[model samples]
Target: MPLIPMKQTVTRIRTEGNEWDGTKTEIRTPMKCAINEGTKLVRSMSGSAGVQGTTSSEAVSSAQIYFDKLADIRLTDVLEYTNELGITRRYPPLTIEIKRLNGKPILTVVSV
Candidate 1:
């Protein structure tokens, strides 16, 4: 069992393409998930080829969605989330992790 309930809805969009005819198809599936949305500080560096460097840190929006069961979600799939106001946001999976409990798969978390 997950500590937090998976009550939010997220759509997983999978794109498949045919190499022979240059055609593509998209399959969308809605899943019950719990999303933890927040911002993380990311540090970046910039410099010229031979010049000095400048380091900066910025806060970037990050979200992690959790599922109770094994989901048919891939790293290549795009995840779409919509709010109550009808604003849709899409993101690709940056990382995917599976959690096990008592030697059984318990939860899957995808970060975007």
Candidate 2:
């Protein structure tokens, strides 16, 4: 079984080495992924007010990308997604997790 019936081919862009040392290297790899774009609620609580507590939530752009279990992805890596119309968007991974889906392991990445 597959978690997604359809997947898109995207480019994973990862940079290695140190910028200060002029050893920066960029690696690009093709990856099959399922991308979901939506809004994520960011919550915050303030306790500066005396005898009062304030909680706030802000809607932010978010994307969830699922990759193969063996995908070499990192938080510092950026994903380049090209739509069917040839429009491209780049997103830096904010979180990465390995989880089981449909009785198989997969890599889940969140970008904001």
TM-score per prediction, in order, is: 0.76, 0.65
How accurate locally, in lDDT, is each candidate? Answer: 0.86, 0.76
- Give candidate 2 misplaced runs (Cα > 4 Å): 39-60, 101-104, 107-109
Q: What lDDT tens digits, residue by residue, belong to model 2 across residues 1-112?
A: 3456437877989889999999999999998888877667888878674654647889887678877664678778888988777878888888777787687676555554
lDDT of 1 by residue, 35-75 (tens): 98876888877776876665788889879999886777899
Model 2 per-residue lDDT at 14: 89
Candidate 2 structure lDDT: 0.76
Instruction: Give the candidate number with the greatest lDDT.
Output: 1
Q: List the residue pairs that clash in candidate 1.
A: none
Please give me the total number of clashing residue pairs in predicted model 1.
0
Query: For candidate 1, which ten residues in a row score worst on lDDT?
Result: 45-54
Q: Name model 1 segments beyond 4 Å from true.
A: 1-3, 40-59
